[model samples]
Target: MGRGTGPSMGLMNDLGSKACEAWLSEHGEGLPWGQVVAHPCPNGWELRHVADAGRDAAGLQALPPGALREWADTADDGLFRPLKSAPTLRRGWRCLVSSHDDLELALGGVYPGGLGDWWAVRTGQGGPTSFREFMGRQTGVYRGVRGLADEAARAVVRACCHAGSCIKDRRWAVEGMVDGEPGGHGSIPCLEPCALVLEAARTMARMASAERTSVALSGEDLAVLRAALERASALRPPPGTREAELSAPDNPRRMKLLLEWLGPEWARPAASPQE
Candidate 1:
């Protein structure tokens, strides 16, 4: 699908460019944003994936501003990246921009409205949508998400919005909780829930509504399950696994939620706060 090109989008683009330029001037060179690192080169600026920040530019794929969208469309394994802010951005690419407009275009191609979101948060003009607000606005397939138990809802958010999955700092919170910490300068801010998170919430809501069948397992069995899930979560997803397919039992976020539900013994702190 094509991106919005209306007047509002143009204004956002301009604002994003202005904010980015100001940030660069204040922070100077070599500051990293999300998975990207930017540097002031002799001509203009050089941007590359954080993984390739230390590599020689001549060795990486040189892409123009216009090609960044295509370059960011897939992962190194050729999987379609459903979330642009996902930590799975492919490395080995470098982009050069001679002007702020070019930099805006290039960054937009890489992170979509990332700079604009950052600007909104920095300027206090926009903020995150709370879990309650996000659910209240849902319709059709996602409308039932409002019925999910509050704790269950928080678990879903924690699982899906975990830094392991996406890099955007979540400012939204479940009801009764305040906004998340505004991170240090240059961090990308998530102002609202994304479609993927909504999908996960929907999946969780459906699971919550399902009939409960008790299957007793010993502590050892539960331990084994936690170990297996922890191992899986740390490894690369299977080639056939779809990262955004929450209904699939093997999806990473689902595993994370399951881990959260299981209350893994290893996850507990050895030293209590009272200590």
Candidate 2:
């Protein structure tokens, strides 16, 4: 039941072990799985198939002694493929470039590094031109500015929309109260986003309690606690605030008080929830 342990933990460990094995097979020399190399497909055919075909054709021809016999035998079916012959280097490079282009298109023009980086590492040469470099070269373009501006605008819009929904739901809960009783148990429906915010607040309190017991509270920890309290205070319903009327005893006020004691910024509000 603990975080990151037991059967679930064992599964994670198994996955990590498999991943390491796969990586070593691909990059490690002298290994059966490592003998095979794949490049992008030439003529825009699928790379995996092309690589397999290339491996098969190369094995059929005169190859040097001590070549990967097992790889060549199973080359047509299994994951392993023989390295492309030295004569096919140019064709392989073309395939690599084409494959890289396809990946860039799929990712919406966001190329992480690029063909040049791959080529440099594979060929053991100077660093290749990277996606970061491409961005650097186009800094004066309107598209660059527009991309950043649009992202920022969207983030602001989402935050404001979330806050508005929270306020609206709180108002509805207050209006739906029976007999004007602050602590009345009414079946008030809440918006999904508002419910999420409440759930998140609850989760944070639980985490704080765990941290308080397990770890020595340092100055940095106090600072974090204070900041969290200030944030809760900012969202707290004003004294007699509509939200306070709907909230249970274990509500935002508890978070606010814990935060206030950590910092001056968390002072309790002057008015009561039903004032």
Candidate 3:
């Protein structure tokens, strides 16, 4: 089916419910989903950040399931989280939910359509949207992204979708891009380009079109820049750093893409899983 008209909301919700049921049946209710851990209790299900899963429930702040949306909307430092699946989910809170539907609702707030996308792929009713397919549908400012060179497109995909930035497995690919390893426990599949990706592409396209300036730098200068970007990539930015602010030269993804353009010698090692 054409991705634009893949499935109705009702059908997707039903499939997502089935996906939740099957997942629980297979992995048990205690298994973690992304950064959240869901445990079936006599009362219903108790949800907490994986970091707090082993902590005493009394030690963590208790929050209503409805509050999860706001909680997940921002990181622990109050920065907007553009990607819900990003590893930066805040900890130190627990939620109580009463029914399977409520549990799904709670999780939906945290991951947004994650369960539906999982089931859609598993059932073969949906699949990844290629970069070409995704950009072809773009309009307005994003229309310029369609003109991005293949090399720039791949770099954007790698920088924006790297596991270091988001945990969702990137099922989508563009020309010259290689497949990424499947994500581990608690990870979900990303079936298409997100808004952030589209915006990043637009930015890169504009950057590629801008007037070029040349500056001479010593070998040591290049080395220092690479080292700095490496350190930046290896650590989370300080609280309040805007992750979605792509125009910032210091944005981690933009730094990574810059490293990509500098060739393999300047490339930083892959970010550690704990980063």
Best by TM-score: 1
**lDDT (tens digit, per residue) of candidate 2 on 119-171:** 33434554333222322343332224222222222222232223222212111
Residue 68 accuracy (lDDT) in model 3: 89
TM for every model, in the order presented, reads 0.85, 0.16, 0.84
lDDT of 3 by residue, 129-247 (tens): 88888898888768898788888888777677766777787777787765553233245778888988888888888878889898788766867778988778666555555787777
Question: lDDT by residue for model 1 over 170-243, one digit each (tens)?
Answer: 77777644355222223778878888888878888877778888868775676676778888876555788887
**Residue 150 error, candidate 2, Å:** 42
Give stretches of model 2 more than 4 Å off.
1-165, 171-195, 201-205, 208-211, 214-275
Clashing pairs in 1: none
Off by over 4 Å in 3: 1-16, 180-186, 233-241, 267-275
Clashes of 2: 3
Higher TM-score: candidate 2 or 3? 3
TM-score of 2: 0.16
Query: Model 3: which residue pairs collide?
Result: 34-186
Per-candidate RMSD, Å? 5.9, 25.9, 7.3
Off by over 4 Å in 1: 1-17, 26-28, 176-186, 264-275
lDDT of 3: 0.74
Q: Candidate 1: what lDDT?
A: 0.74
